[model samples]
Target: MNFLSQDKSSSRPNKAIIILSLWVFAILLLGFTFRTSLDEMITVWINVEEYSHGFFIPVITVYFLWLRRHELKFIEEFKHSLPGLVIVFIGLILLILGGLATLKTVEQYAFIITLTGMFTIAFGLPGLRVGAIPLLFLIFMVPFPQFILNNLSSKLQLISSWLGVEFIRACNIMVYLEGNVIDLGIYKLQVVDACSGLRYLFPLASLSFLCAYLFKGPFWQKVLIFFSSAPLTIFMNSLRIGIIGIMVDNWGTEMAEGFLHDFEGWIIFLICMGLLFIEMWLFSRLSGRKVAFNELVLIPTEWSGDTKQGNPDIRFNKSVFLLMLLLIGAAIASHNIEGRKDLIPSRKAFLNFPLQLGKWEGRNDYLNQYYLDVLKLTDYVIINYTQPESGNHINFYSAYYQSQREGVSVHSPKSCIPGDGWQITQFGQRDFPDFKVDGNALIINRAIIQKGDSKQLVYYWFQQRGRTITNEYLVKWYLFYDSITMNRTDGSLIRLITSVKAGENIEAADQRLQAFIKDLIPVLPAYLPGKNS
Candidate 1:
């Protein structure tokens, strides 16, 4: 009775429980209402990693509680905090505003809001403070905004490409480098942003967050481990690519092409993970602290001293289990939606080339090519032209010429006119070197051609979407160019010339355009650029 009286657990109202409930409800609502583009981007990852690493979150959560068990044992009994609810409300408002403003901004703020809300709820709760780890876990399930991901991925691309080039060149492999592309004589390997090992980021981040919570390492050391993942992942992936290049050089394409490709990625991942474990072990040893493995057991009966509150609520445990089940379901549902393949249009429906043109090809110089195989071509159209003059005026001419050859104009199709059935979803100046359009300038025009298996691709033309021509290097370039792509009946893309430059008169533009068109006329070889099939 004396010991129980000494404990402040009974004095505090169970406000923390109410606060936590509200927090959980809010997050559940957010997860429900918010369908995100980032979520879609990670679909492939979810599919591949779900079975393999799906247990990681729970395993880590349990480990964290174990490590903090000693401290958590004394946590006051659950209590509601009305003030905490106000804090959560404020955070909710900010989070909603952020989501509305921009998905990227919202993603950046998401974790912050989560942390604040969780801490606010856990503040007054003694025994319930352990819930923070689980609350924090929700952030991992949220999709990251595209802007942040794109920028991070781009940086990874540069780092991985640079390291890969250096490593491959060291092997005396006759390779030419251009940005992320490696010209390995016969085959060009563009270290696509995905291959930059950016995929490992979320997993590593998850691990780091868990480590930070579970370990008693120096604050700087924890931060260091988290940030080091970027370079560590990039370097390891580069090494993997380098090894693959060497193997391909010695063994030929067959060994490097199929099974080995996947095998190599896994090998690199394991190696990196092994390195992470070693680093953690070394850090713990150096800090004179033992690793915590069995820290989460329930209090001993001797130490329990009648602190048991009416037999651990079966409902509480059941709620946690049910919540976990629901999370798993939610994750699965999100993945299902994300991975759903687009229904292919019927060939006849797609190929009904209407004389009443809703969308039709305008005059263009370069030939458009469509294909089903992703690796057969660059899946992009190239425009080649030169400017004779200098200054903004010359740049304008290059742009105008390219623009004339790139896209269809809004003018009525002479073949047949549609009463506003066709609306160009996107049309504007392109920002590629020779593909910009400015004030009055010399331009070029040539015949536009469209061919695909189903023919819907000929109508659903692609644009750059959005870009501005403020680049200084582009301003100096003699040629302006860019690419346009349309969706194929299949999931592949049908590439068309989005932009091209022609600084010369119409006659010269016509000559070059004809030559370009003839080179790709009737049929293009499979090896040419923009030929995916």
Candidate 2:
């Protein structure tokens, strides 16, 4: 009777393991086969922010799982709730729809479906075992929807701008504040989105989760730690902006440019971590818990085996485990490769002008001048100077409505690296130069510039297909340009242009255009590179 009881109990555990494995397998199969929008969505976050820098995220994940290993090992075979399975299936469907919608180029609406599914799956199940698995998926929060992201980004900009203004003012720097911009008599600085607190969201979220899981306190304490990230991130990011602002005010913008700028980022992050630790220590004292910093009490229970000694690994089931690991690795690699392929441009051809001879090869001078004119009309602007480093191609015609109100003045979307939005749209034609310049007379593509009472449409192109012509040699070229239509409920355009080059140019293109523009719109400032000037 005793032996039979023991055998029955042991069989139960094995059955539970089989069931759990099946569920995990099912989730994986569904996740891979149905396609969750996670790949593309998460890719955007990883591209925009350097969140995956180093092995920080991986290390954190490993540590977190290791810390919970003992507790996780004894996790009961979760009750087989058919209702929960139904809910998970619904979530799976939503995830599939989101992915399909994304593939169809309908991104805005996909998020709703994905979020609904995630929320349903998390809510439908009960108990720690149930919610824990779904909640672990919250790492997807990094890729916020565009609308939400924009709103959050603007909030971050406002915080950074406010701090920058205060710091500059405290330093007795002569400055005029409008929105998120500062006119320091010499240079105008706009506290744009990138500099905003938005950068810390993913890191803070990850850290908060780790702290929550590790802390041996009430559930509310964990919740509090997770929620504290908002204020913590905002406060630290403000400090970063203020420090940078002070540097800019005292030692010119050059002091805050280049790789040194990134160095400041790390310093700020370290300081933020210090603050977090201090706060945690304070909390522990108040709560009267002698919580150890690295304390993780791992214990075995009913489902756990004796860790004091391994049972010779039961003769080592190596082949099956190796194959399973290999499969997981291959899935991850395939996803990453596919993601990279999706990002690269499908076509590589120069744009040819209809009326003019020779294609508008991507010439630097031409591309710069082309985009400069188009952007002038928009109230708020986002520019991409590089392709590989930068992730998206976007020029906001009315972005000013957000940042300008937030007290940011000098706005620039360009950062350190070159990526997307660098190449100009070629329309239907092909062939662009490596670089081209504009003379006094700026040539505008008539087809692109549309005039309307309430709205306007402006299209332009930029390409870099030519080599250095300074040494007296014709340059090779290709054609690329961006086209955009502007809608203005409010009257008045931001920039008034004179002319744009239709094709190839001789002599100094920029000088000629600059002279013309200076004569034409005296109020407009001379073209200055955001990072340089």
Candidate 3:
């Protein structure tokens, strides 16, 4: 009997080794296959401040898994699952589509799904149930797509600016709020993207998730702890802005720059963490339980109680083997498909675009080098056209990209205008029955934006592959659709802006843009690539 027990104990290590080996092989294979996606995620982690916390997510996930190792090992049996293979197949399909579209966001999500499928296949359902939270936590590593980030940042900037101004006003300081700029008598504070609270929000939210998971509390309390991060971050960020404003007012403008500014941001983030802890403590008190702070906040040492000691039965899952074969086949097919480049139609460069359109004469303008780098446009044109008779000048801007597969696509003016201190007060689509391009009526987004007392009439549309899209969501949909159907993701944004002068009716501004659009319609195909071109 002693000899039999010794033999069983010896087999346990062998089982562990086999399981570890399979996991390592699967992970290494996934890493090799999704190398580009991983590189892109790492690039964002290193460069983008808001998502820098992504660097620690993988380590945290592994730590969580390690903590649950005992529980996973005690499972009664490991069985091959058909459902796991089905999930793996779906993940491979997503990988193939994401690869063909060159969408890093899609590919990154697919990588997570594929990893989950592998885990489910290797560990079986019971093991997965034990480690589910850690697997789900991996999602925090992926940075949001640029469009969503832009919109969120813009909204946060506006909210922080408003709250900061109100706080200053309560302190008896004379302050004026215009969009995202706080105008204080001698100095102005612009709530740029960095101050939008996202830098604090993402990391703090991740921390809150960790805190919620570890907090030994009721379900409702855990949820409350997780949801509180947003408001806490926003409030703390606004408080920081108000403090900066007060310091600048008393100590001069130097208080708002360099080390002091960044130090304040760090301080605010720390305060947010403290607030979350305070929330957890409050919940503990309300629940009629006195839990120690260390117990509530520390990493869990154990996931589950130990089970009977025995050598659990284990077998190689043929379904997982078949799934691996399918993955290998899909990887080869994706590599070949991605290697083929899309067809780029020839078109006239923006430089050769006509400077004179009917009665209007134009002078070209150039964007700053920093702006050009940020935009990453393949080609662009910016011109101020004036009707010499009416002295009505309109700014015409167009940005063209040869391909948008790599995520550098057109940014909507709706997302960008507020960043420059302009607030969009009115927005809707306008149809020009008289204006025709290739026998189709013109439709464009018309927005009335204001800054201080100044107003401007803006018209913009996305021209892509013979489609004129006024809606931003439709543009995104078409980008995905065209990437799959036509193997083309080339597009351009055309914007026309005219100021509403003092005491001048907005109708005049509208008419001015309409007239310019009429003149600009026929000539756009020369520069913007379309089906006819």
For each candidate in the order shown, give its overall lDDT on alpha carbons.
0.42, 0.41, 0.84
Highest lDDT model number: 3
lDDT of 3 by residue, 1-533 (tens): 99999999999789778855765777777787778888999999999999999989889988888766766633223244655666677878888888777688888888888888777776677777877888888899998888789889989999999999888888888888888888888999999988999999999989899899889888999999999999999999999999999888889998999999999999989889888888898899899988776666866545533545334455456564565677788778778877978778788999998889989899999999987887788999999999888889899999998898765888888888986568999999988889865567788999999988888999998888788888877887888788888888888999999999999999989988887887889898877777655
TM-score of each model, in listed order: 0.50, 0.49, 0.93
lDDT of 1 by residue, 238-264 (tens): 887777666767777664577778788
Model 1 gets an lDDT of 0.42
Error of 1 at 111 (Å): 8.4
Off by over 4 Å in 1: 1-83, 102-119, 122-134, 288-533
Candidate 3 structure, TM-score to reference: 0.93
Number of clashes in model 2?
Answer: 78
Best prediction by TM-score: 3
RMSD of 2: 15.9
User: What's each prediction's clash count?
Assistant: 24, 78, 0
lDDT of 2 by residue, 1-533 (tens): 99999999898768656645654663464346434344554455467673453235435444543544433322222232334434444443433333322331122233333333332332333333523533453453434444345546765676667777777677777766554666676666666667776667667667666665555567887788777877888877777777777787778897567987878877777776666666676677678877665543222242243576332211111222322343355345435533431111222111221111121111111335564452332232222221233221212121211111011121222210011112111212212232222312222321122122111222222111111111000100110010001111111112212223344231233333333233323212122111111
